[model samples]
Structures are given as C-alpha cells and as structure tokens.
Target: MNNNVYDCAIIGGGVGGLTLAIQLAGAGRTVILFEKEQYPFHKVCGEYVSMESYDFLERVGMPLSAMDIPIINEVKISSVNGNSFTRKLDLGGFGISRYTLDSTLADIAKNKGVTLLQETKVTGILFEKNLFLISAAQDIYQAKIAIGAYGKRSVVDKIINQRRVKHVSSEKNYVAIKYHVKVELPPNRIELHNFDNGYCGISKVDGGNYCLCYLTKSKNLRDNNNDIKKMEQNVLMKNPFLKKYFTEAVFLYEQPLTISQITFNKRSAVEDHILMLGDSAGSIVPLCGNGMSMAMHASLKAFQLIEQYLDENISRQNLEVLYHNKWNSLFSKRIKTNEYIQYLFGRKLLTNTVIAILKRVPFVTDILINNTHGSKF
Candidate 1:
C-alpha cells in the first residue's frame, strides 16, 4: 500500500496514457502510470498515424522527424472482386509499430519523473471523498485523479459498464489481427483491400517491415472453424490483392497478434469521475487508418483539462463535463463518418461500387479521407 497520493494516476500505458503522463510529469506534476505488460510489446494496430498527430507527438518527446519513419502519402483500395483504385492523400501520415512507439514513449514518461509500473494490472478504481483509490495486485495506490487510457476493451470496463452510453450499432463483435511481414510494398503508400465482412490494410513501418492488419466480424472466423489460416484462405484471400500478399509476403511472426470483441460503441469520456482517454472513450473503425493519431490527440485534450483541474482552475464536475464535450467535439463526427465507411466496405457490392466511384472521381477519396482525419494538433 502506498500512502502518498499522486496528482494523477493513469491506467494503461498506451500512447494516450504515456503521452498524458509525460505531459503531466514534464510540468512537475506527480503521475503514476500502470501497464499490465512490460514495454516494447506488439499490439493489434494498423501502425499508421495521420499527420494531425505528428507535431503533437514531437511535443511529447517523440522525435518522429528524426526517426526516418515511412511517410505515406498515397492510398490504394481494392474491393472484394479485385476492383481497385489509387488516390492521393490530402493529409498523409507516417508509420511506426506500437512495439516501437509505446516503448519509446514509456521511456520518456519514466525520464520525466512519472512512476511507471510495468506488469501491474489495475484491478479497480474507486472515487471516494474526491480522491481515486487504485487497486492493483496486492497493493493500493492513491491519486487525486484517475484516467482510463486502456485501449479498446478491458476488464476495467465492467466498472463503468452501467454508466456507458449504449451505442447498439457499435456492439457488433469484431476481431482484429496483425502481423509484421517482409513484403514488396511501396514505402510511401498504403493499401487497403476489402473482402466480405472485413478489410485489411498494409503499409511500411519502421525497420523495413510492413504491417499487415485486418478486422472482420467474429462470425467470419467461426464460419471457417475458428482457424485463422482457414479464415485467411477461405475469406480474406478471396480478394486478389489480399491473395497476393498472403502468398508472397514473408510473415515475420509465427503467430499473428490478435484482439477480439472490438467495438466502436460510444463510451462516455468521463465515467464514475474517471476521465476516459483514447479508445477507452471511443474508437474509430480501423479502416479509417487514423485511430493512433486520434488516441494521441485525445491525450493532448485530456492533458490540458487535467492541468487546469490540478491547478484548481476548474471544479471536478466542470472537468468531467468539459472533457466529455471536448472529446465529442473533436472525434464524434469522425467516428460516425468512419462507421459509415466501415459499413460500406464491409459489404461486397457496396464496396465494389464505392471503388468504381472513387476510381472515376479521385477527389471523392480525398474528401472522405479528410473527413476521417483531422488537422494537426
């Protein structure tokens, strides 16, 4: 048990949590961060980050400009029947693996005086008398504020499940899988291939590796007897582009990293007096290729609000309501737009038609992309 209460305690050491911790600690505020796993682990992410977060990441200690990461400026889309189109991205993005990005950010968080605890799983968070009590393993820690930055889904969600806004449409069960592979792909371009019930994205990341990731309904896996390889061959490989990648790319991992039961349901930005950041608050569909950037952007929003609350500039109630509004203002429209996109791409005929339209009027692709992505923060 720790008797000292920190200024803020962040659950989950993801990009958002790590970035927020860095921000708070850099300003001489006490922060304690918890991560269930040790640093440098892989996550089921697209590995693409939009330009909106480029400057913000640098501000929080990521030297992306000097990192020599791949700058992606073009996009190629292929439908289930192999119909395809290529378009220029209005606001391009960069690629770096979660394995690399999170670890680097974690190192920065530690250096900035954040008490980062690795392999510590927070079992529960309770607000009592205006302070947060965080329980992890056999230890209890205290903080003035608690933040939930634990990605898409977690057991911690059960605590706030009662207060969550139910977005029924976003409740569909989805599975996401990722692999680092050696493939012949253009470094400055990203390719998205849509198949029945799902889509896969591939782009060059750091270390000359390409990240090949996909998200699909869980039923797709069950239809193939819950065998990943069978699902790839029977469902995903139906698309010509995906077939080529499957047959040609040298998969670096023996087994792909995967996450299941992913949902895009609208979650309250503030629940039980604990501020929710990043995917915990709400996640955009993976097909949009902007989730990583959105998560980081939310962190900046949260840091500013948290800073004000810590300085006694705002009441706790005000902080909660303001964060909820700011988060929705920043990302609600984008999430809704991406949800519609995910719907279109998940259907075979609709996907093929959209690709045909995009092929003829390439600017439409730019408009759609701009809608899903945001300006630099």
Candidate 2:
C-alpha cells in the first residue's frame, strides 16, 4: 500500500472531525479525514443545533437557511404529574435532521479542499519521533498531527489506554430511540415530556417532520420484556401529553434508531498522539440539550491548538498539555454542572420543584438556560 502523508489526519468524519477539517483546510493546511460510514446516514441524535452553532456553521461556509428546517424559539418542559412550564428560549436553536446536517458539513469540507476517505475505518495509530502513522483497514497514512474526532468509540482510544472510570449504577444508563415522524406540532417549539423512568423530547426537524425520541433506564424496558413498543405503550403512554402525541403522531421514518447503554462519565482529552474531540472527549448529560453545539465548539478549540503546533508556534508536548488544560478549563465545569442537573432530573420530585421554581421566577429559567448552554458562538 502507498503511504500518503498530510499535515493532519483526522479519524472519524463526524461533526467535530468534519468541522475541523474544513477549518484547517481553509487556513491553508492539508487535511485528510476518514469515516467508516457514507454520507446521509442517520445517527441517534437530537438533531437540534442551538443558536450557538449558527456562527460556526456560517464560518464553515455552510448555509443554515438553505437547509429549510424549522427554527425553534421556545422550550416547554412538562411533568408526568401535569405541572408544566414554558420558557422563551433565550436564544433560538435550529433543527435539521442529521442526514442533512452531516452531508452538508461533508460537502463543505470537500469544497474547502479536505481529502475525505469515505467507508474507511481506522484500525490503529502508530506514534514515532516526528510523525504519526495512521492505519486504516485497507491502507496507511502518516501525518504531523492526528486528531481523534472519531466520536464516542474508536480503536485509537484503546491503543492509548485512555482513562476510564468504573461503571457505577445510575438512572442515567438509559436507551435513546429517535424517530422521524409526521406530526402537526408547532414548528417553533420543542417539547420535553417527563415519564416514570425517563423523558421524551419532540421537535420539528428539517423536511417537515418531527423527531420524537426518548431516554429511559434500561431496567424499565427490561421489566416489560425488552419490547420497545410495549414499553412505549405501557410506560410512555402513561404520560398524558406523550399519549396524545404517540396516538396521533404518524411516524415518517420506517423504525426508530436506537443507542443503548450510553454513559456520561469523565474522559481524558489528550491520549497518546491523538487529541479527542466531541463526545469522544467527554459528553454532557442529554438534558443539557446542547451536545451538538458542544461538539462544534470543541472543533474550534482543537483547531486553535492544532494550528499553532502545525505552524511551529508551539512544541508538541506543550500543545498536548495546552489542549488538555484548555479542554478542562472550558468544559470541565459545564460537564460537572450537567452531572448535578442530571441527578436532579433523575428524581421526579426534584424535577417538579425545579420546574416550579423556574415558573415562579421566569428569569431564573433564562439564567439556567444560559448557564447550561454557553453564549452563542
């Protein structure tokens, strides 16, 4: 096999990786990106990009308005007990299906001169004196900088022996199932309905369809014979609000896409020669409702450090240290905050109380939203 070399090689062509490739290529660096999957594939994601991601999307030369998806301006939270609170979202977020968003970003990366290797799965990384070798299933490539934008799980993480926390029993070990459904829900609103053991969210996506998804502890579904339909009917339908939607809503896609056994524990940013980004670095609780923005934001941080090192403005050791420090400084507090909020949401009573308080002092809701989701970038 031919050994091709580039200034930077990115594993995983997810949002973070694609964004970084575009940014780096735009800045006059040669970047090659590998993705195991082809474009327009659906992943189990909320498909909502907060207002914070608008600027980044524009900077990357992707048109948000061109997508023709809904723009949501309000967030509504409801309890299983029927107490509800409505907060005008501090900053409106955009909704586009991952099928569209991912393809759009990939197109932008290609247009910006990023070498994209589709259907390529990276098998391992080899570290050496001045360059790192990246081995894919079929070929090998080398680069001065290697980025782990691989999203969630990859062989690079294991090769580096990155830190891992012992799994602890928690209510957060839930399954998320998302569906594209045809519904008459408001185009500018996102709804969150709480149930006995979990919560479900419904919002408009691009292409005039709604994304209905839920997260529930695995045990709840297991007790129901691991039947998703049965669990939705028995447990989810128990919520009055969800019952109305599920009964009336028409599923647009064939079947729901699911991600099982999701964990939100801490992870190190720098591992071996690869710098982790997006969910691979660390994920915030889904309740925060802004992981999309976080992933895009991480690409910006990764690009800054990478640009400096590639330009010989900093030493490799210092770049790794600085990347880790910056990653922790900017995101550690937010992750911890989300963890605390997740605990509160895990308990039904705390969630009700928090919603009540937010309803009483509406501004508190805005503050909470701003804190949970950083200012628009």
Candidate 3:
C-alpha cells in the first residue's frame, strides 16, 4: 500500500480476493486488495454456499456459524409447468448475502494488516523483471505476486490474454439479475425453478430475507424490449413458481441488482505472470449453486501455493505450474461438466424430462449434485 513493492497485489475484492488477502496477511505477508466498490454492497449472487468451505472460512476467521445463517439441507427444483421434486443435499449448504460476507472478510483482512483499498479500480497489470506493475487510477504499484479475483468479466481479461481461449464464442451476450426479498420460502431449503432459456434460485439468507437470483440469455431481455420486469413476467413467470413469488413476495430493494455480459466459459488458471482467482480463473454456471464456495476454495489453493513460493519453498515456475494443475484438478471438471448440464437446464421440455427421470431415481440426483460440489476443505 505504501510506495514500496508489496508481497502480493490482489485485484478484485469479492469472495475469492478477500479470502486470499486475509490468509496472506495473516501469514505475515504484505497484501493490498483493490475493489471497485465499497464494502457491505450487494452482488448478483445466489447467496447459497456449499458446506464444503465452512471449515475453511472459519479457519480463515469468519465466524459463519455464530452468524445464525440458514442451514439449507434440501434442494427443491421445479419445471416450467410447476412439476417439482425435492432431494436431500449430500453436502448441504448454507446461505449468507454477499453484502454481509464480503464486507466481513474485508474487516478481517484489514485487521490482519492487508491494505484494504476500497473503491480502487485497477486499470492494467504488467509483469516484468519477476515483478508486477499494477496500474490503478491512483498510480502504478509494484508487487512480487499479483492475482485476479475480479468476477464474471473484466477488461483485465483481455489485458492478460484470458480472452484468447474461446469456450462459448464471445461472452458479451449473457445477463444475470438478483434481488433480496421477504418471501415465505422454507429456511432449510433452496429452490431452483426452470423455464425456457433460464433458471431462478431462491434461498434464505441472514436477517430473515431471501436471495432471488436468476441467469438468462441476453436475448430473452432483448425480445422483451430490454425491460427486466416484462422479461420476468413473460419468461420466468411461465415457471408458475416464479410467478407466485413475484406476485406476492415483499421486495426489499427499490431496484434489483443486475449485471450484463456474464461469461461462464472456462478460463486459464494462470495467465502471463498473474494467477487468476475466483471468477477470474473460471466462472462455473451459477446453477451449480457453489460458485461462492468455489471462489473461496480457490483462495485456499492460491494462498498456500503463493506462500510456498514466497517462503522460498518452491521456484516461481513451480509455483505457477502447481497452481494451474491444482486448480484444474479441483474445479476444471465441475465447470466443464456443468456447461453441458446448463444447456439441458435452459430448455423447458428437456428440463422437465430430466427432472422427472432423476426424481424416480434420487441417487442420480445426488451424483449430479456431488459432481458439482466438493468435500470439506
């Protein structure tokens, strides 16, 4: 944070970036975390976190259990016509808003000596002489290591050649929307309802509120004249379940949180001389219901490897190679498998048939769920 070069310069302050910062700082290493937005903000996230990261988070300093968050053990999914089924989650998850989660991590990161730079937008990053020159609006700073935890999309993707690897043509057409509302959904369950071209997830977070988030093709909104409400009423409401909540839930915000050009395509874990973290590395489809945990899980991986590199336990070359392979082994298959699974979820008839088949044989559902989730870290 001072004029001196840092041990680690982290770009983006979402779940992955913040968690990495906390660990690095707590390890007695100098860290600086850059976030475009201030703390305690809302993000377009499902808010449901798989229990896999529960111990890791508490180990890093988040008193998550004492926070009194919902322990969601059941997953309820429905089809367009309202045909639905419930399955017990194998490694069930919990729910907490990004507003509470990220900000809380920011606080811990600061207390542990991380230079928490809120509202600081990083413009570019350059690697030279085994050091990183981070270009922010304020000024260029130097670091021995740099990481990108920026979510979904960023200009830095192009800056680091992350755009060269094409997985889904271009990533400029996907859109996602989210909101918090007071709904009468069961606190111990998370519901995902499917319709043509998209799906919506509902689950309880802290403060007796529910997180209502969904992802849809951008064309769905385009066809409805770019009106979110109209698109919801016409497409999402066709699910029946979405319609019921939309018509009756007490919306908590004056407006919904929306993001555009969301790309779920696979990305490289290591680019140039920078290590990618969270959504930066690879953003899995939100339908997996574990992006938050994956992002945090990634932090655990990056922090350990980077620390070994800093402690002279390994060479930089070995550090980068290990991070790449470890990240892929842990998350690559899940994201790739979900890409195909997501295609099935987008079509109404395919979703209905798939759900109906899996309903009779519930263990298949567990296999799919387990495929997407991971064991406790």
Model 3 local distance difference test score: 0.89
1-377: candidate 2 lDDT, tens digit per residue: 44667999998888889999999999999999999999979988877778888988888988876668788999888776657887788787888888888888999999889999999888878888778888887677889998888766555666765444447585557788999888877899998888777888889988788888787888778889989999999888877888989899898767789988777767878888578888888888777778878888988988998899988999999999998998888788888877776776635777677777767899877776777777666
Q: Sum up the clashes in candidate 2.
A: 0
Question: What is every candidate's alpha-carbon RMSD to the true fold?
Answer: 1.6, 1.7, 1.7
Top-down TM-score ranking: 1, 3, 2
Off by over 4 Å in 2: 163-171
User: In model 3, where do residues sit more than 4 Å from their true spots?
Assistant: 162-172
Q: On residues 1-377, what C-alpha lDDT tens digit does candidate 3 reach at each position?
A: 34789999999999899999999998899998889999988888999999999999999999987898999999999987788999988789999999999999999999999998888899888899999999887689999999988887777776775465355543235788999999898899999999788899999999899999998888899899999999999999998899999999999899999998777766788888788898888888899888888889989989999989999999999999999999999987888778878877868889989888878998888888889988899
Per-residue lDDT of model 1, residues 1-377, tens digit only: 79989999999999889999999999999999999999989999999999889888998889998897999999989999999988888789999999999999999999999999999999888888999999997899999999999988787887764754344443388899999999998899999999999999999999999999999988899899989999999999999999999999999998999998777777778889999888888888889888888888888888899899999999999999999999999998999999788888878899989888889998778888899999999
What is the lDDT of every predicted structure here? 0.90, 0.82, 0.89
Clashing pairs in 2: none
Clash count per candidate: 0, 0, 0
TM-scores for all candidates: the values are 0.97, 0.95, 0.96
lDDT of 3 at 314: 95
What ranking of all candidate models by lDDT puts the best one first?
1, 3, 2
Top candidate, metric lDDT: 1
Q: Please give the RMSD of candidate 2 to the true structure.
A: 1.7
TM-score of 2: 0.95
